[model samples]
Target: MCRWTRQDRQRSHPLNIQRDEYARRRRQLMRMAGEDAVLLVAAAPERIRNADATWPYRQDSDMHYLCGFPEPDSVLALLPGRKHGEVVLFCRERDPEHERWHGESIGTERAVELHGMDDAFPIDDIDDILPGMIEGRGRVYCHFGSEPEFDARLLGWMRRLRQLRGGGVVPKEFVALGHLLHDLRLYKSRGELKLMHASANIAAEAHLAAMRMATVGRHEYEVEAELMRTMRSRGAVAAFPPIVAGGVNACTMHYQANRAPLRDGDLLLVDAGAELDCYASDISRTFPINGRYNREQRALYELVLEAQLAAIDEVRPGRAFDAAHQMAVRVIAEGLCALGLLAGTADDVIADGSYKRFYPVKTGHWLGLDVHDVGDYRVDGEPRMLEPGMVVTVEPGIYIPPNDTTVAERWRGIGIRIEDDVAVTRSGNDVLTANVPKDAGEIEAWLKRGMS
Candidate 1:
């Protein structure tokens, strides 16, 4: 077991996910894959932004989930019944020249020691070595089509194996890795939950800062800057590009160009989260730009908040994954109908799907290593049951397009969403991002304290 020590804490980031935990996950996955299979996981390719510039490298979530190795040009292999080694890693060799530009590469020997791999080799030698390991496997598991180059190489290895004289049995079947792997990822471990809570706390502070700085005449990006600064200062990064939409801009669900200026009486909707140690936290909050919501904004905002609360209540164990969405839709439909935004009763609005005009997206998604993390929402054509250790976001919103002209003008162009990270528990659920205020009155009071 890789135990965390005071020295380790001083030398590195506080979130110390033990090596044994990763090993346990690998063992669990291998057990599921069975002894006759060979599993291969490829690292994420670094992407280029423009000339000579590259976007920040993010490790493949699947690869990172298995081992905490943080380098590209790496491959993880699992041969369950292999006597020589069950876990293998092929990674970049140490190069002083490359180290001068980039950072040090954890060479093969260090990789074996640090990540507890049974064997390690240079990535450049994979083609020469890996095919021999794959020659006898009955089934091969990998993320098919994710990386064309990797897939092509894998296919080439298999073809060569088939042609070789007196070679051992080549893999007869190729399996999609996600179906098995993603299910494991859906359930969070203790370490993962800790990291997620930390991520949510960092994001909560950022959202609070955005609310405090959201005054009239401030540009959307300015508030976004505050969010970025807060997350970065806490040694975290944005889980996704921050969405700081103001007024009618909020009507657009995926609004990204946050350049609009804040105006008095218009609601500012900030949808953002922080990524800490690869675990992501997503939260969305809509507040008045001038520390006070107008009548229309207050009505929509309160309705969204009510819907979010109702949805969060359905996040307990045994509930279906979509239980929150159903509750949220019910509440939002009733509220909208009462507000005269829709002509029919709440039941009719839901049954006819008319409520989708305002509430387009789902109530939430599974939150973990990726913001919109892995795992199938359905199993056997039915909604999957919510289990303990499953983390989800309860985000309910209402977006009324500005030009609808279908109802009163006061209700148009007002967009409101209240979102929080919720973790299902044995008893009920825990709201990870509860540090931030969601109630309209609480938001006004929070802003007032900051202004004072």
Candidate 2:
């Protein structure tokens, strides 16, 4: 059987992301901020899942972007034109007992060597050390309000610096880190695209597994479990909670109970993705629980598929960011009118916002470190233009609520969505998650092939 073998896992988890990549990113951001500003980024704090157990620790995206350090109780400081060192890191010191309980941490010395940092120190001395480093800077750039405790500590340091007139200088302004950082993150580097492609391929495998296992009499959670097994075996985790909605349950956009039993003649919508090495890939596919779509289900599924393809075609360099969404909406609106679900013309339906009853959300969003990744959809009060290296999700869905009386009885309670991760290239675009079949006929054939 084709599965995620040990060799396959090793091949997918490559050493493409090197210290040089992180160093390059740091240098670029520092040059953008200039010599007058100091940038501070903190690692994500560990959260309690319940009484004593802690949830899995994930590093902050900005921190990961700046330096590929993966640890809690860590802080990064980028001081432009510093005489001693331009890049500094404060992280947990080596502790034998702590390492025994948890895991070995990237101590100061290792952090500097492995992550290309100029200097590293124990995090406990941040209060005594960091303020001195920041004293002379004119502006402090940090992602404030994200971690209130860290924000308070930063403010306290500034307050302390103000009190000490002998201190060299105090920053006069505080800037949101996202202003300069997010834009840098939007463009995927060669290393990032490699990881994202691996991520998408892993998720596609899991979706195929789910499709094969989702037979009538199977519970939704069972299908979800299969997806988890497939992704986890590949050293990846779900980007978000897998949405395994069947039949009428699919009408709710974010239905995540994942406990419903599969029924024959019902369409199953599975919106799930996998995160590989912190890079994410999102894909959504609707197929038949019994391995074949009926007449009514196939009709709507084809419409959603058409919309998704039309939207994906618009993901090209120099194209408007919203162009894909507009095309998808137009296609769906026309399809709904043809099916007698809407009364007016496609243009009139869109202009009057009458099509929202069936399709409420936008076509898609940015996809990366976070499932719904960063990067502004609009800039200067207008939709931004698509650029090479930008990755987006082209998802177009139609949901008909079970109780809505406007639709025919057969059409009601049917929901369909087709999503794929597309990366804009210099030539045109590439579908990262195309391994999983999206066409109705292809889906039926794939399901008939059984487990891989």
* Candidate 1 residue-wise lDDT, 63-126, digit = tens: 9899988889999999998999999999999999997888666789978887889999999999
User: lDDT, candidate 2, residue 347?
Assistant: 94
Q: lDDT value for candidate 2?
A: 0.91
Per-prediction TM-score: 0.97, 0.96
Instruction: List pairs with backbone clashes in candidate 2.
Output: none
Clashes of 1: 0
4-112: candidate 2 lDDT, tens digit per residue: 6332343345644677888999999999999999999999999999999999888798898888788899999999999999999999999999978886666999787
Lowest summed lDDT across 10 adjacent residues in model 1 is found at 5-14
What is the clash count of model 2?
0
Q: Give the runs in model 1 whose Cα sits over 4 Å from its true position.
A: 1-11, 163-165
